[model samples]
Target: LRILCNYAFNYLNIHKIYCKTDNQYAARLYEKVGFSHEGTLHEHAFHYGKYIDKFVYGLLSRDYLKK
Candidate 1:
């Protein structure tokens, strides 16, 4: 994740990275890696037999560089 983010920010000149997930573990990982909650999509996906809420996360290039 660190390598990817750095490559994109430094070489590719990407501004930010976005991630979406319904699991707390994944969300926490994103946060640990410098992303912050951007928003949520209510009932964004249908799982087994119910709808699942998805969260959007974002990490800005400046913020990523700071880490």
Candidate 2:
């Protein structure tokens, strides 16, 4: 994740990056890497048989550079 962020911000010249996950641990992992908790999408993704809530995380170039 860090590598991707570095490349995105440094080489790709990305302004912002966002990701969504249905797992709580994954969301925390993103937060640990400087991503902010943007929002939660209620029942936004479908799994085996039902819809699940997805957590959104985002990081901006400025924020990534500060790390």
Cα RMSDs of all predictions?
A: 0.9, 0.8
Model 2 misplaced stretches (Cα beyond 4 Å): none
TM-score against truth, every candidate: 0.92, 0.92
lDDT of each: 0.93, 0.93
In model 1, which regions exceed 4 Å deviation? none
Candidate 2 residues 1-67, lDDT tens each? 8999999999999999999999888988999999999999999988999999999999999999986
Candidate 2 least-lDDT 10 residues: 19-28
How much lDDT does candidate 2 score?
0.93
What is the lDDT, from 0 to 100, of the residue 32 in candidate 2?
94
- The alpha-carbon lDDT assigned to residue 64 of candidate 2 equals 92
